[model samples]
Every structure is written in structure tokens, then in C-alpha cells.
Target: MPSASLSVKGRISMINFNTMNLRQENNIRRRFIMKKAARFLVVILSMMFLWGCELALIGIGASVGVGTYKFIEGKLERPYPIELQKAWDATNTALTNLQISVSGSLLEGAKGNIEGVRKDGVTVYISLKDEGQKVTTIGVRVGTFGDRIEADLVHKEIAAAAGL
Candidate 1:
């Protein structure tokens, strides 16, 4: 038969073993939680990095677009006519292509003439007035060498006519 001291000692050892097992389980649980938290942080950081890249790209696109617009605007000059018909044709094209809609009388009254001679060419001066009796005012001037500078010239003329 075991002595009382031996029995008490055995019971204490068993209790200690159980306590160690419980501690091991708790440690495993803590490690699992830490791993999940780490993964969550990585995902969040990745998303933020992607968003930052997209914003940077958008900024670059806007800068490029603005630069292109300014460059085109710089190349444009007022249209000059070599002949009367050329001046009249340019003016008519500008009026026809106008974005704003006005009455027939207003369109009819929009007239242009080869006003002066410049070193580059003939300067065609176009005018628009409210001939519609309903108080409609529209006018634009387009200058071109009848070549590649047409679109920008048209835009400048329209903007000038609209007082923009």
C-alpha cells in the first residue's frame, strides 16, 4: 500500500500535467488569432497600394490631356483667304458646324469678308449679329491655311465669337 505522502505527491503531479496541457491549448489558440490578424493586415495594405497606383495613373492622364490641349491651341492661327470664295467658304463651314442652334435669319445674317492682308496670308473677318428679330446673337471666325491647322483655328474662332 502506498504511504499517504506518496499518494499526495502522485495527485499533485497529475494536477500539474493537466495544467500544462491547458496552457498548451491556450497558446495554440493565441497563435491562430495572431496569424489571422497578420493576414488581414497584409490584405488591407495591398488594397491601399493598388488604389494609390490607380489615383496616380488618373493624375497622369489628366496632366497629359491638358498638355495636349494647350499644345494644339498654341498651333492655331486665324484663317486667311487667298480668294473671296475661300473666305466665304471658311465662314460658311464655321457657321454650319456651330454647336448652338439658331434661327434661319440668324444664320443668314452671319457674314464675313476678307478684311486685310497679313504677311502670312489674307485675314478673313467674320461677324454675327442678331438678325432674327428675337434677339439672337452668334458669330465665329475660322482661320486656316486650308491645311492641317484647321480644327484648332475653328475652336479658337468659336470661342472668340462666343466671348468665352
Candidate 2:
């Protein structure tokens, strides 16, 4: 009788030890998952904050129908009071007048991108954005590294062509 009691006590202790170990493992796994999730959230929040700061600093709001011209992100952007199709046609004519051959053209909905290359191998890119209500914006970039003067000249030609 004494031996049987000892054996039962030993089995109960073993079961208790196994249950404790399982609980500990579950706690550790839960903590690990929580830590990983926290880290991921921190990274996502940081990216969002950085993007917001960039938009603020660049004054994206100031460009809407302001009809102002400025250089941003290596490109010259100008807002105009014109329709999308008209602006796109004028831009193509302006490039042609400047002796730039249109190499590629992409138009989707109310936006367009036109790429041209000069005889001297200088490339120019023109982007048009129509924000509805007769508010259109034009962005110009010249060459790979961007030439501000050339871009301004192209913009002037485009404005003339558009009768703006």
C-alpha cells in the first residue's frame, strides 16, 4: 500500500511539471508574437510620418490652381487654367516646334506623359495632370539630371502654344 501511494504521488508531480512547462512555452510564444507585431507597427507608423512631412515641406497644397511655377524634385511644375486634351495637344505642338522628336507618349484618363529627344541626344519629359474644373498642371524635366533653364524654355513654349 505504501509503494502504490508513492507511485501515484510521483505521477501527479510529473503531470504538474508537464503542464507548467506547456504554460511557460505558450507565454513565451505569445510574447514573441507581440514583440514582432509591435516592431512592425512602429516601422509602418514611422514611414507614414515621414511621408506626411515630405508632403508638408513640399507645399503640395500650394500648387492647386495657383498658376505658379516652381522647381520641385528636379522637375519644374506649373499650374494652368486649361483643359486636359487642349493642354496635351499644345504640349505636343510645342515639342515639335522646338525640333524635339516625340519618342514615347502615354495618356490615361486625365493624365499624360510625353517624352521627347532632341537631335543632340538631350531628352525631355512632360507630364500633364488635369484636376477637373479647368485646372491643369504641367511638369517638365530636361535631360537625365534635369536642366532648369531648358525646362523653363519648354514650359514657355507650351504656354504659348496653349494660348495661355
Candidate 3:
């Protein structure tokens, strides 16, 4: 099969006529450069904002760790065993200040075990007493994903601390 072609000519106005003059070309180039600069500025500003947020978070963690430790020391009742009392004292010191102080207790028979719940920044893990009197083990389990103590993690932390 042979295809027949038809040819016609007029003013090719349908095509874009961009290469008219040097001034027009420069204007277009300037516009492109301005757009790119604006985009770069936006990106740099976004990065700076994120970096600032990260620094703020670190500062908060340090403040919480110190303040919570002090708060715990102030709250405990006297007359408990020296070792058990000291464990509580140390646990509070170790926690971040952002901790919500959900609930905590020391088990009767187990002198060293103590449990505590705190937000501790982003993730919520139940802090429990390890076998040793000095170290408090953080449970891998996460608490309820929200801002409350309804999560099963808190209950488990309490039970573990209470020696149940």
C-alpha cells in the first residue's frame, strides 16, 4: 500500500517562536535562575528547621532524665530497706524528665525489683528491675501508642516490679 502526502504552507504560528532575540533569551534564563534559587532556599530552610527540632529533643531528654530522678527521690516513703530504697532512688534518676509517672511499686519479697512507667520521649517501654539491685531493665514491649497509661505494657511493668 502507498500513502499519499498532502503539503500546504502558511504562517507556522502554531510553533513556539522563542529564539527571537538575545534580550528575550536572557529574560527567560533569568526567570529560570530565579525559580531555581527559590527552590534551593526552600530546601535549605526546611533542613535547618528539622535540625533545630532534633536539637530541641535532645535538650528535653537531658532535662527529663535529671528532673525525673530528683522527683522520684523526693516522692518515695522512708523506712523501706536501704537496698530497695536506693534502687527506687536510682531508677528515678535514670528516667527522662518527660516521664508521665504513670504508676510504680516495689514487690514485698523481692527487695530489689521496682517497676515504673514513663513516656520517655517517643516510645513507651515499661522499666523493670533486673535481678541485680542496680540495673533497671527496659521491656521490649511498647505501651499504648497514645499519651495514656491504658497500654498493657504498663500493667505488665507493674506486675513485674511488684513481683507478681
Candidate 4:
């Protein structure tokens, strides 16, 4: 038997209403929706991966699980194998040894922020965070726009002071 058809707006729509059961029509609609949803999910995941790649290129995103030294967001950061207190002391000693006058300091629980002013009048900020037992993360930034060389020097000084 020929399937019934209707002409609407110069387009012919075929309807096998008499041949296809309601369950079959419903299954077809469900499959279409599922396919569309899967396509959308793939697009979203691809966009996320691209964004992560951009961040990595700009030195702002690194694999957190690796615990490696990384330059991120205009700062240098590294995970040190030392306690929080020890890290804090090392940072302070480093600043002093470099003749950088500390302008401000804040220590709250497992996190610390130390701000200092160099002899050249450039400001520097050092941040320390406790990552785990006997593990601490240190970050160094110099001036408002970030001086990479100065930041690197500060990090090296901290490591030397800590004997790490």
C-alpha cells in the first residue's frame, strides 16, 4: 500500500501513520534527540580542551597533579618538600638576604602573603600555601606588571635558604 502524503508550503510530508505503530514513532524521535545531545556534548568538550590549551600556552595552566615548577599568570610557582612554617621562614630569610624590605605580611592558617619593596622601589609579593603534609607551594611576583627575572631570583633565593 502507498503511504499517505500531505502537501504543505510546497513540501510533501510522508506519514506512514497506518503502517508504523506508536512505539516505533516514539523510538525514532528518542533516537534523534539522543544523537543531537551527543553532538552538543562533543562540541562542548572540544571547546574546553581548546581553552585549556590556550591557558597552557600563556603559562597560566599546568597539570596540578604533577607538582612541578611552573610559571603561571605572571608568577613563578613551585612545590617544595617542606612544612609550611619552614617555607615561610625560608621566604622571609630570602627577602631579607636580598635586602628587600618587607612592607606587609599576612599569615592565616596554612596560607601566607608577604609583600616587600626592593631598593629600586619595585614591589614584590610572595605567596605560600600548604599543599599537604610536608609539602608547600610557593609563588613569587614582582611589581605590578610582574618582573620575571626578579621573580626567578626570589624563587632561587627561597630554595637556597631552605636548602632545597
User: Lowest lDDT 10-mer window, candidate 1?
Assistant: 64-73
What tens digits encode model 3's per-residue C-alpha lDDT throughout 94-146? 44333545355444533434344555534443333333323233222334444
Say which prediction, candidate 1 or candidate 3, comes out ahead on TM-score.
Answer: 1
lDDT value, residue 128 of candidate 1: 36
Give candidate 2 misplaced runs (Cα > 4 Å): 1-67
| Residue 20, model 3, lDDT | 53
What residue pairs are clashing in model 3?
64-96, 64-97, 65-96, 65-97, 69-92, 69-93
For lDDT, candidate 2 versus 4, the one ahead is 2
How far out, in Å, is residue 95 in model 2? 0.4
The Cα local distance difference test for each model comes to 0.42, 0.85, 0.40, 0.82
What lDDT tens digits, residue by residue, belong to model 1 across residues 29-138? 99999999999999999988787363343233213221122222223222221232333444455545543222232123333322322335434334433322222222
Q: What CA RMSD would candidate 1 show? A: 16.4
For candidate 1, give the lDDT of residue 53. 63
lDDT of 1 at 148: 31
Error of 4 at 21 (Å): 58
Backbone clashes in each candidate structure, one number apiece? Answer: 3, 0, 6, 0
10 residues in a row with least lDDT, candidate 2: 57-66
Q: How accurate is candidate 1 locally (lDDT)?
A: 0.42
lDDT (C-alpha) at residue 32 in model 4: 100
RMSD of each: 16.4, 11.0, 15.0, 9.9
TM-score-better candidate, 1 vs 4? 4
Error of 2 at 98 (Å): 0.3
